[model samples]
Target: MSADQRKSPTEPQRGNRPPAHGRRRILITGASSGLGAQLARIWADDGRDLALCARRLPELERLRDELLDRHPHSVVHVYQLDVSDAEATERVVERAVVDLGGLDRVVAGAGIGMGARVGSGHADVNRRVLTTNVIGTWNTAEAAIRHFWDRQDGHLVIISSMAALRGFGGAMAAYSTSKAAIATLGESLRSSLARRPITVSTIFPGNIDTAINAGNPDKKWSVPLEVGTAQLAAAIEAEPASAYVPRRPWAYVAPIMRVAPLSVVRRLVG
Candidate 1:
């Protein structure tokens, strides 16, 4: 069967369970750049508390200052984190829970895509991509879900990609593989937590002008950071099982990507 034709896990309809309001405190990793930074800005503007973590201290500090200046009522905490470090991720998350009193939501957006092409004669580059994107995402998810289990309430948001819908070649090889792994992880969590209070949302975003794709040659249907992120924020608020942001184009394009001729897929995605 094609990727789009597979049956979803057995569970009630995702829409019937709307997220409970008052997700006042949130934790976001990879807050140093790209989509992570934009999500922080939107949440802070809502006057919600935030715990932003990333490897770049300066960027996190700058984001914290920007948020405080625009919304002084919002409380923003910054942390220096390398999500690939499992122990450090656990510690940072624990401290964040203490700092924020409790975390109502956690966005596992920490990842890297180094554009490592297949057969590049160097495995190290692809290794780094997998370690950071797959293992790093796992660290972040485990740390956050630990708290969620203890508190018996939380939201886990896994930021996947449209590339995950099918395998790819060239620069996207490892990155696509990593995303596919985490998408399954998110689906598994959703099934495991079906009876619990915790909610797991998997996001498949299509081409939102970020650093990850700034160097692509044929940039088709790409939106600016703000416009894309606004759609992402809305989807996150809805807390669906899975969604493709800028939903119309993606909702239509995704199915075609799965079933289209292989040559057509190469031209469209490449």
Candidate 2:
């Protein structure tokens, strides 16, 4: 298929969808912690059935237990899948769709970040970070899109970052570029899916205090995970194709970067 063409769903829709009043079924990757975990909690409170995936089995199990305890009637299934592994990711995503009876929404929350000076030849770090943040997110979104196409009524949320708004500086070369790729990928998917019954939401979040940033000592640069996740959740509910989380000073950064000369950004970021 052409890059602009929308791909149809791969499987037949299964089970009877609940009444309009019933909760949405959502599958979220990287659900073991941070914004992913927060999204799971907020959605479960609304009675949504959940299929959560992450590499951390213990954390995923904990989230599953918590969700079940909070919403006794809701079904929360946890899968140990790393989105970077294409075959394994596809298999587990297929299972999540079947077990959840089909998905009404998907949040591709799996990603990684790294910063240690690009030319310093942090080869291993750069490679691993790109694999996790870019390709891993791609894998998750591709799987989710297939399921959404079959259901013909669902939203795909792609979690990018404010760093994506502009190519960052200092040691963040690889990390910023990877996130920018995800943001652009989501934007393209949004256009392709517009004619279809499916919706694509691209979220650009600012400095969320997730484990992804745990290595960074600059705590002042980060905001509470809730601040970012809450904004993202609201955008998901609105079903917008693109959003800038927190929607304030952070949102302003994107336009500034877009309009400002690259030299200015380089000076500031450097």
Please tell me which predicted candidate would have the highest lDDT against the true structure: 1
Give the C-alpha miss distance for residue 53 in model 1, angstroms. 0.7
Pick out the ten consecutive residues of candidate 2 with the lowest summed lDDT.
1-10
- Give candidate 1's TM-score: 0.90
TM-score of each: 0.90, 0.85
Q: What is the lDDT for 50 in model 2? A: 77
Per-residue CA lDDT of model 2 for 1-270, tens digit only, reads 221111112332222334233337788998999899999988877667778899999899878777665555556778898899998888988987777778888888887776668678777888887899899989988888887787787788888887786777666777889989998899889888868988888888766778877766643346688777877788778877788777765666667777788787554323
Give lDDT for model 2.
Answer: 0.77
Clashing residue pairs in candidate 2 (N, C-alpha, C atoms within 3 angstroms): none
Clashes of each: 0, 0
